[model samples]
Target: MYRFLLTRQWLITLLIALLLIPTTIKLGFWQLHRHEARVARNELIAKALTATPEPFDSLSPAPGTAVPADLTWRAVTATGQYDPAHEFVVRKRTDANGTIGYFVVTPLKLSDGKGTLLVNRGWVASGDGAADYPPVPAAPAGEVTLTGRMRADETAKGSGGFIKDRAGLPDRQFNLINTEQQTKETGAPLLGGYLELTATTPAPADQPALIPEPNHSDIGPHMAYAIQWWLFTAMIPVGVWVLVRREAKDRAKQQAEPEVTPEAVPA
Candidate 1:
């Protein structure tokens, strides 16, 4: 009865089942790790958003120094003059409605004149093509104060894979908001991190829609996906067992039937 287990078809099925068991188990754990990371990030965002706003200089006193990772999304205030000449737009940005857009990135010449800070003013709808740059609203003139959340540079290690620097993009268009990269274009020392603009003193008409406050409320469906993967692992074994039981019954029934011999009429 068990001989059939050695057949090519059953052997292949068993091999496949063996491979799937570990694969599903690993996938489940991978999703669980993702779930845990999202939860932690959400907590951090919530904490930062609730804290009191701090002076940008206090957080980053020195130019070219990246902001501490934990301080990301913390509200910060800075005074600066907008240098529109070096301003550019980040490509492939989107709004809350999933509409494709561009992020207006303007260099803010700090009032102290020490260095410039890249400010992501907000998103503006894109034009027909990459070369057709959207008409960005001019930044407020003179020295003005602004409030925004601090964000880390969009380096490969910093953005958590959300953004990365790309080469050969159109002039005045960028894929990532990297301070180091912008420093070369602006011809000025830049603060390590950029700001997600919230409010500006002497607020001009909002042409580029302001970037909304990040939502930390959703934990996402990672946990549900993880559970689903593990459930698939359990089903694999049950399926194999069911197949084996059916095979055994079929073999036993075949044996129970009486063997018939041909009549010796020809003799």
Candidate 2:
């Protein structure tokens, strides 16, 4: 009964089914992990966002290379002068509604005058590139203060690579939020992390519009996706069994019938 499974097509089917079971199971587990991570991040964000703004240096010292992983998303404040010459636009930022735009990242020279901090002013709509650059408000000159959430340097995490300066944009344009990379451009020591500018002291005449608040409530469909993949894995063997059983039945019928021979005739 099982001999048919050794045939070319049946064996191929068995092999594919065997391969898919573990693959689907592993994918299902991956989705579950994604869901769990989202939950943990949300819990962290809920606490971090509400906390009072603290001095930037208190979280991490000045002229540092990277922010601690656990300290990200915490509210922090810094005071410095804008280094407009070193400013660059971070492209492809989007709003909560999914509008394509760019962020103007400017370095804030610490009042101590020894180092600088990158302040992401905010999002601005992209232009037709008929001109040299996107229209963004200039960072104020002289001493200024900034307040916003803490975000770890992009290089600190192994998320993805940054797309370097794009073509046809203004002179100073970048595709990364990586402070480490931008620090090299600033020609000054950096504090390892950048501020997502929320407010400024003595509000400037111009400022980038606020970026959309992050969505923390969505656990996404990972759990359901995982279950669906697992369910499909479970059905693979059932399908193979159906085909094998039908083939066996056909063979049985052929064996049950008697073979007929032509009657001998005068030759």
lDDT of each: 0.87, 0.79
Q: Encode model 2's per-residue lDDT on 124-151: one tens digit a residue.
A: 8887773447888888877888888888
Candidate 1, residues 34-132, lDDT tens digits: the string is 999999999999999889998776786355667786899998988989989989998889998989889999988888766678899999998878778
Clash list (residue pairs), candidate 1: none
Model 1 stretches with alpha carbons more than 4 Å out: 61-65, 156-168, 264-267
Query: Against the true structure, candidate 2 has what lDDT?
Result: 0.79
RMSD value for candidate 2: 3.4
Worst 10 residues of 2 by lDDT: 155-164
